[model samples]
Structures are given as C-alpha cells and as structure tokens.
Target: MADDTSGLSVPPKKLSHSELKEYAPGLQPRKMTAKYEKQKETLLRDRKSIQQLHKQRVHRGQSAATQKYESRMERKKIDREKKLYPRNREWKDADYFIDQYLKREAQMKTERVRARKIQNVEVKGNDEVMFVARVAADFECSPKVQKIFRELRLYKPYTAVFLRRSGENLKKLALVRRQIRVVKPIRQQVEDLIRTRGFAKVDKQRVALSSNQVIEERFGEHGFVCIEDLADTLMKGDEEKFNLVTHFMWPFKIDEAFNDQSNKVPGVGRSAADSGRHLQDKVEQFPFRFMDSLMEQACRRGKSRHWMGPELIKALPSKKEAKFLMKVKRKKVALKAKERKIQAKFDAIAETDRKVARKLRREHKQQREEKKAAALASKNKSWKVAMKKSAKAKEKKEAKRRGEDRRLIAMYGKKKSTAKKRPPKKQSKVE
Candidate 1:
C-alpha cells in the first residue's frame, strides 16, 4: 500500500533555477548541457543575417540593371523624337512658303533691331554653316538633286563636306535634302574630323593633309599654312574663308559600316556598350528618318549646335523665289488643265470607236454561227436518209436469204427439222 501511494503521488514540484537555488540555500543548480543547441541557434541567426544581406545585394543589382535599361529606353525615345520629321510639315505649297517668308522677314527685322541695341553690330542676312554628307542610299532622286550633289563634291556614298550657309547652298540642299545628311559639328568634333580625315588638293588629285608643309603648299596663297589654320578658318565660320578651305580639302570619308570608335586612349573614346553611340550622337541632331530632313532641322534650336543663318530660313521657305515659283506654278496649272481637256476629248472618241467595233464583232459572230447551224442541219438530214436506206437494204437481204432457206428445206424433204445437234458425249469407261 505504501509503495502504491508513493507511486500514485505526484512528484514534488520542480523548481526553476532561481527557485531551486533559493530553496537549496548553498547548493548550486546543475550546469546546463545545451551548449550544442545554443551554438546551433547562434549559427542560425548568423546564417539568417548573411542571407538577408545577400538578398539585399541581389535586389540592388536587379534594381540597378532595371534603372539602366529604363534610362536607355528613355534616351532612345528622345533620340527618335529628335529624329522624326512629319511629312505634312516637309513639303509645303507656294502659298504656305510665301507666308513663312513674310513672317521670317518680319522676325529678322526685330532680330536686327535687337542686335543693334544690344551688341551695336549691324547684322545682315544670316551667319550659317553646316556639315554635309552624301548618303547616296536613295537613287531615285531627281537629276537636279544629283547635279547639286556633284557641284558640292559629294560624288560618292559617304563623301562629306563642311558647307557654310548661303542662299545658293541652301537651294542646293532643298533640291536634294533627302539624299544627304547634315550636321552642325562643334569645335571638338570638327577638330577630330579634320585631324583624322583631312585632305589637300594637289595637282587636281586628293592628297592626305598629314603634314603642315602639304597644307602650306596647297593653300599658302590663302594664308592657310597649317592644318590648324584650316580648322581655325572653318571654326570661325567666315563665308569666304570657309568656302575656300572646304574646296581646298577633299571630302571626308566616313564609315557607316564600321561603327566602333577609332582606337585611341582606352577611356577617352570608350563607353559602356559604346557600339559607336558616341559617333552616332554626333549626328543625333539631324537624325536620318524618312520624312525628317536636314533642311527642316535647320530651323529648330538644339543643345550643342544650332542653325543661326538666313540661308536655310530663306531657302527652305523660298523667300524671294516663292513669288516667281508661284507664277510658274500657275502657268503649269493652266497647261495641265488644257491638256486634260484635250485628253478627255480623245478618250471620248476612243470610247465611241470601241463601242462600234464591239457591235461589229457581235454581228460577225452571229452571222457565222447562223451559217454553221444551217450547214450542220443539212448534214444531219442527209445522214438520217442514208441510215434509213441502209436499214431497208438489210431487211430485203434478210427476206431473200429466208426464202432461199425455205426452198432448200422443201427440196430436202423437211431437212430433218433443221435444228443444231449437240456434241456427242464421251464414251463411258465401262463401254
């Protein structure tokens, strides 16, 4: 009974560490053997922290990549916007151009007045310049456009030139804007292009301007002794000096296929995924689009290079030429109307002749068909008569043959019933 009661009784309440120590007074609690478990817990916390840091690093990488991609797309969108030129704004009629010219003249007057008050300079038409490159990608251009290209020394695809703005040059560009690319090169770009691709005309032949002596020998009369002198004159934008220097130098040859920047010091010309974007950015101002043309881009102000002369304004808008063109256009319209009236008269006569011919063809076809029907009916009637005669002859011959048989049968005394006999049976084996 005692053992059963001890077994049945609940164990004395277990004390916590502090309670057991207080109850025991001087006795110490057992040291915990959970070092391995504590170590595992600590390891788990450290691993969790490491994983968190890794997640953050990965997230940062992903975010940076996303931002870079988005920025690139945005830049492409802006480039496309700058490059796009609507066709409706491209080719305006004489009336629209006349209005534009009048407005431009009025605006120029205001600009001149402003310049006089501010800078005390007597501003004239316009000081304009441009970089022209012949793409020759479009061959369907007019002969006039080709003539302009030849005059500008843009003889082949990728041929390039620096053209100072003038009324004459503007007219040429207007005639062949779609077949060319126009750029407004800055000082740095101009220097690079000249140093890398400059040429001199010697004895009516293209020679590279690699040395100052060659430049001095070719252009010494014009005081352009060195390559620097040539570049300086061009940068100055003087109409006369610019023209002489450009004609003196052969047209530049740019590579549309090789887009990578020419080799130079590592970081200078290199960029992330450069892929010739730096070079492409040089011409981003006047983008190559189907409807967009350099002639139109000359009007818009941009960040680096801008149009500042009346050459493009007057030429693209056809300032003085608009009136003359309008008169010629009226004459052309009158002539076209007269020609259309004459064509209408001829078409009416042709239509009448076609109707008469069609009626004659129908009558001829009907007469031939009628003759063929009569011939076929006569042929069919003759064939039917011949068939009838052949049937009668056959019946008479049958009757004669039957009479002859009857006579022979009578003479032969009934001819033993005259029936065909069956073949004899084979002899039996027993027989």
Candidate 2:
C-alpha cells in the first residue's frame, strides 16, 4: 500500500483549521451571522431611489399628457353627441333637404293628378258624343228601343231630334215603325191569339195563297211592289193609319230590326233594353199554371215554397231584405256543409274503430302465440332439468353397484367364481 501510494503525486500540507480560519475569516463558521443585512439595506436604498425617480417621472408626465388625452376623449364624445342629436346643424340640413324633396314630389304628384282628371273629363265627353251618335245610327222604336230612348232622354221635353238625311232616315223610319207596333191594340190581339191557340199549334199553322192570288197580290200589271209604295198607299195623308193586324205584326218586325241593329254595335243601353224586352216576352209567354202546380205540390209536401210572379209585377226588394236573404242562404249552405263534415267525421270514426279492432285482434293473436311459445320453452327447460337429475341418479346408482361388485369379488372371487362355473361332460358320454 506504501508502494502504491509512492507512485502518486504528494499533496500539499493541510493547514490547521484554526490557522485557516485566521487567514480567511470568511471561511470561519460562527454561531450567528448578519450576512444579508448590508446587502438588504443597499437593495432597499436602491429601490427607494428608483421609486422616487418613478414618482417624479409620473408626476411630470401626468399633467400635459393626461390633459391632452382627456381633451381628445372629450372632443370625441362631443362629436359623437353631435352625430346622434337631430338638433345639430347637419341633422337640420338633412331635414331641410328631405322636406324640399318631399315638396317637389308632392307638386309633381298634384300635377299628375290634375292631368289625369282633365284627361278623364275629355274621355267622358267623347264617350257621351259617341254614345249619342251610335244611338242615332241604330234608331228604332220597339218596346225595347222605346225604353232605351226614353232612358236616354229622347222623349224628354228638352230633347232635339238630330236626324241625318242619308242612311239615318231609314233608321228613323224603322224606329217609327217599331213605335207603332207596340200599340195596345196589337198587344191585345197577340195575347188573345196566344190564349186561344197553343204556341206549338200556332207555329205549325201556315198562311196559304193560290198562285193566281199571289200574282194578283204581288204584281198587278206593275213592277214588283216596293215597300215604299205600300207604305205610301197605306199611310196616305198620314192620318194615323192604324190596324190591329198591322200593329200585331209590327212588334215582331220592329224587334227583328232592333235585334239586327243591336248585334251590329251592342254597346250603350240599346242592347240592354232589347234584352229586357226579350226577357219580358219570355215571361209573357211562360206558363204560370205550371209554376202554380209546383208551388201547390211543394205546399202539400210541407215545404216552404215561393212563386215569383211576373217580373214586372214583383215588388222591388229593399237592400236590407236582399242582404238578409243573402245572409240566410250563406248560413244554410254553411249548416249543410257542417252536417256533411260531421257525417264524414262519424264515418271516419267508424272506420278507425274497425281498424283498431282488427289491429287489436292481430295483436292478441300474436301475444297468445308468444305466450304459448314461452310456456313450451319453460316446459322444455323443466324437462331438461329433470332428465339431467335422473341421469345423475342413474350414474350414481351404477357407480355404487360397481363398487359393491368389486368389493365382493375381492373378498370371495375364487370360490364364488368356481361355484358359478359348470363342467362339460358330454364328450366322455359320446366316446
């Protein structure tokens, strides 16, 4: 060990601990020390100086910079307030612009309305003149024509006839003829004939004239007889030549002329008046007895019935009565619709019930089958357990018997075996 230590370099002599402590007081250990006191004091003094400098800097910066920031914020707030308030100058300017625009728009609208009103007036005046012209062109004096002309103020005391010389003369003459046809005498004759003979019988009947009579009647040594000639011959002197037969035939001819004229234009009150006359004729020709029979039958059935008499004879309905009937009909229709809806609901309920019952039956059948299956499964499980138990018991019994047999054989195997064996002596007997 001395030799191994001799190969290593010698270390320097270690000084005594107390001599080292005297040389380096810093290395000396003491029971108590104030090592951090001076450093803590220096650090606290530095911190105090830094704090004072920071406070002076804050104080110096606060006045001008804070004032500048506050002034800027206040200016921004004032600008925002101006933007929001309507009393500001900008808002007033916007309002003035809007008001001016609205005034201009309203002025333009007024001008448009006035222009439209003037145009409508001109159009109405033109329409009236055209209406008058049309009526003059297709002048007739059938009951329908009379009614239209009367409605148009043709028969008024202030009315002035404006007859044209050319084609209008024929139209005026046609009107005159129609007027003459509506005479009371002609109407009475036609009514009497209608009452005496049915419409079908009258329609089937025809007027017949022999060939000589036709020749004599149509052309008696002169050219074809013109309507003007007949009119001149018949209305000579214009002493109000009136005949019952002519008056009766006149209405039909007048109606035909009116119808033809009406078909041409079909505007104004003329066509409407013609339609009214046609309606009147139909009403006059209608069988009242049939309506009476229907009413009587309805009355017998205990149902309320109304017989609408001749249209001309019926009282004009008041607005209130018409409104009331309309309301009543609406209510009746609503009630009928409600009843139908209720019937449909009942039918739906019945159908739903039938479906529900069918569904329930199907469910019940399925449930029964499931229950039966569950019972069968449970029975099978029980049978399996019983079979397992029986098999276990049988195995135990067999094991017990085999153990007993082994013990018996071990105790009396040779003697029991010899006694159970049988000798064979049949071979000696055969020798």
Q: What is the Cα-based TM-score of model 1?
A: 0.36
- Residue-wise C-alpha lDDT for candidate 2, range 164-283, written one tens digit per residue: 122222222223322211111223333332233211111334322212343245445543233333223233212222221222121121222234433332322333334434433443
Best by lDDT: 1
Off by over 4 Å in 1: 1-125, 237-240, 256-292, 298-431
| Top TM-score prediction, candidate number | 1
TM-score of 2: 0.22
Q: List the global CA lDDT of all models.
A: 0.65, 0.42
Question: Which lDDT tens digits does candidate 1 get at residues 1-431?
Answer: 35734434343587687766555555665675799789989999999999999999999999999999999999999877754743334565897769767865754564444323423322233455577766553243345556667898887655678887655565556556556666666766677677777777888987877778887776778887766777788888477888778877888776532343351113222322242233344444322211234545654557321443442343333445668878988998999899999999999999999999999999999999999999999999999999999999999999999999899988876655577899999987994
lDDT of 1: 0.65
Q: Rate residue 157 of model 1 by lDDT.
A: 56
List clashing residue pairs in candidate 2. 141-175
